[model samples]
Target: MTTTPRSPAYPSSPLPSASPPSPAPSSSALSSASPARWPLLDRIEGPADLRALPHHGLGQLAAEIRDFLVTKVCATGGHLGVNLGVVELTLALHRVFDSPRDVLLFDTGHQTYVHKLLTGRQTGFDRLRRAGGLSGYPARTESAHDWIESSHASTALSYADGLAKALGLRGETGRRVVAVIGDGALTGGLAWEGLNNLAASAHAGPVIIVLNDNGRSYAPTVGGLARHLDRLRGHGPDAGVADPAPTAGTLFEHLGLTYLGPVDGHDTRAVEAALRHARSLNGPVLVHCVTAKGKGYAPAEADEADRMHGIGILDPVTGRPPAAARGKESWTSVFAAEITALAARHPDLVAVTAAMLRPVGLHRLAEAFPGRVFDCGIAEQHALCSAAGLAMAGLHPVVCLYATFLNRAFDQLLMDVALHRLPVTLVLDRAGVTGPDGASHHGMWDTALLSAVPGIRLAAPRDPATLRELLREAVEYADGPTALRFPKATAGPGIRALGAMDGIDVLRRSPHRPLDVLLVSAGVMATPCLEAAAALERDGHGVTVVDPRWTHPVPDALPGLVARHRLAVTVEDALADGGIGSALRTACAERHITTPVRALGLPLTFITHGERPELLARAGLDAQGITRTVTQSLTPRSTP
Candidate 1:
């Protein structure tokens, strides 16, 4: 959950560097002046200022913003390619709609940097996703203009529908509700559900559904839906265009909604016009706009590195950087390497993703064995069941999905996969307090939800190397369904950090005194546990902190470990119900080692959007929070 600001090939020592105003080209100069080279974009403060500029200058502004985004994202690590791809669409939406009043909902808010920049957040772009800085995704709390604080993919259409219905019920008028969704998001079942309902609407309310089709989700999309999209994209919107007519038009029409476009998304004028036309329509309408992912940047455009999905900061002029320095490899990177190696050995080994080949680091496997790797568009449920069927066919299928999004496929994972005890290796990425992207995208529930599966063996790796070993182990374990959960942030220094994973590291030594208190922490929060131990040690409280890498299966050594201690504390980043803490309490109760056990985790509530550390701190997960809670628990209860 913590990231050190270490950049590769950065100015070593104090080398002379130019204080250059970002290398990206800015909007045209405003006549002759002292700062004649200054860009007009820097002068514009907000949307009103942007509106003041002529339409001719908007393209220049988008270019300036793209340059600014590239420069800033390079410095502060966050989502890069998705934002760059949607510059024109973001700019056009703001220019057309009166946002904050006219609800503009961003699907999978990862692509909202330009939306943020236009809505008076340009000044803060340099510090995006950094702790206490701007969030990487759209957060309603951040600004009044941001209507929906969403980070999870494929849910905005539902929000848009509900809001539209609410507006109608309240007799609210004049406001146009627009949902900017991607081709990737369309793969989710919720989007279809919203589309089905919205398509069935009787009231002719003005709702604009912008399909920002970039043809890639996390990685190059897969499955029938993606192929259907290819037909639509290839055949343009011409009446004579063939290929049995695309699904968007007929599919929505059958469901009773209007369908428009296959418009050129890169051209702001065209997109703006299409939006205006959709706004003029009575009921729900879909405006399909096609744009290049990583639009203007040549390297991003030319490179096939995960569909130019995103990469680390590069020199603006050359778009070149030295080979990504091998620090401790991330769990995702390790998964990619290991999965590729595994697939090479076992012909039956195949990989599947819900349109997240790149973000989950499955791009290498996807590239190596194109036939073996399946990018199942944005449909998480379909991806799960498809993997189940593959497993049934004697092929080992690994479904690599983000933890937050995989919640949509719980029923499928339970009924279709777990019911049959299918051997599907689910690699759940972003399984904790995913920094910056906010609450919706955070993978905070997989442990609790998947833990209940009858045959599922849930495993979480503390570091990258363990992740590789665990992934290989899970794939080969053909008896039942298995899952490995990990967070979104760069993987910490691997097995070396844990010292030993031979049945949980007993970090704090309280050998002399009878072990009175034991703290069992899971996943990435172990770092804070170590800090909390130091804090508790200073207060003369003996603490034994254990990182139980395998929280479920309730490690065999745990009973003896718990028996040795008088009080036990179980902490996890997940919710309390059915989580590590809950499991620990159950285990203690079953083993008859009462010892006054306490569970510490996220409160039973739907947490809102904010900086990751701030959210965690507010939720009593920080070192200070842990220290206070542990101290309070040690206090004797009043009889009254």
Candidate 2:
């Protein structure tokens, strides 16, 4: 599918002034209105007020709410399309159920902006995804209304099951549990697993599964199930329920939940009526609500490319935002260019992604060589296994997945691919502190996970050039499994000539002072390390910063570098456990080099949502933190 070559919108633009509807809430009217007012939601302070108003006013309110969201998110920058699609549904949800009592959970959490707007967080929208601002995803820490802090897709059902089960266990049956899942999320195996478990439980609680069918994933959600949804939605309400065969039809029905939908999700009354009916019924019932991804927005409506899956800043009038000027190429863009370049040279070269194409920058490869780029739905396991099979068939399979999602195929990556010693290159995108999406999406665990696989060589490049070089080396090295990782953001000017043999390279040096500390940084986190080294140098301590292009197996010349310095520091964007930091410590221990080494990365805890720099700083992976750690280690300890 050839997408219109439109310039991509960037997130850097300042949001335009929120054109709130005329007549802000008056003091007397606000006091007279219901006390259960959603405080932060100035536009929609209370659903009680909405229910009290005439039906015609409800539609007007929905329009105002959409405009409000657009304005708020434009300033803050958030999941714009998802929130846009759910304005009416969100209205209906608020209208129908008494929330805080009725448990409403968002599937991928991107659609929660509307929910947030309704639940007294309208002002917080201005700080959306910012450093000290409100989070992009729902956080229990943010509000009591937010029950589950879900950012990852395909998890609402599981959360619903567990919550519902726990409610039953506690003998608390007063509340209604509603889970809003998306069509894209249905591709994940966990959704099905949750469905099966929910079905098997004898003592079931009040759980309503709302399937928000948008007919799109990161890419146009590919699979037989997606095709089935098309048929179901196309059949409309007139298509009465009847079993064609003896076996339970539909995946959800097969799992034993009462399947009821293909409803017009855009229509507020229809969705509310369907939801009201589902609420009346006991046990688990799947209510499939069919809605457009970028609903009510003209430009997004015209957009065929995966329903404009979250653009940068957008223009309110035209729905087209200012694009970021091209500077240094992003790691994703670099990877895509190199993959396309390599694919042209070797016919055997093939690329695969587990639902991600545009985000991973594989769109270029898909456009250049359409036949070779295989988007194996959202099934990461299938993608990895398929890559293994492709390798067995003499094709160089490059399985591209997000750092977090690649964890799903660990077994397949180990036994099927690595054990077979297949020529499979796993390209892990978003390999570090992923800025706004929160802990669930961070690619921090890939290096550690992939490192455990015997014979699997892991290459983490610091820049675009080394990324290209590593890809070439990975493609050429037909002996065993090779993995490459980069950050969620852009790659800086990477030093290619680490050494003559393309091994570890010392990026920066200090001429004035002695080499007191050796800072080893991997992947995109090297930038901060360099800055830290510079800071230490000014403080009268010389620091040698090195980028071990390939983090796994610890480079041969690294020992010599370590021996030269009195203090050593291993800095990476990954988690401290089993990551590059651990590897360096182990190397020092094994080599019998008693260099006082300090390991710095993400701590052994789940981090919350924030901007990239803020999250890094909190994790102690930022330049200031790195300098402090190095400086402390370099200082002599006094004993009285």
Lowest-sum lDDT 10-residue window in model 1: 1-10
> TM-score of predicted model 2?
0.87
Candidate 2 lDDT by residue in tens digits, 192-223: 78876777777769788888888887667788
Best candidate according to TM-score: 2
**Model 2: which residue pairs collide?**
40-120, 498-505
Model 1, span 394-461: residue lDDT tens: 98899988888878899999999999988998888878776566666678888888888888888877
lDDT of 2: 0.76
TM-score of each: 0.82, 0.87
Give the Cα-based TM-score of candidate 1 against the true structure.
0.82
Q: Runs in model 1 with CA error above 4 Å? A: 1-39, 42-48, 235-258, 306-315, 318-327, 489-513, 524-547, 602-640
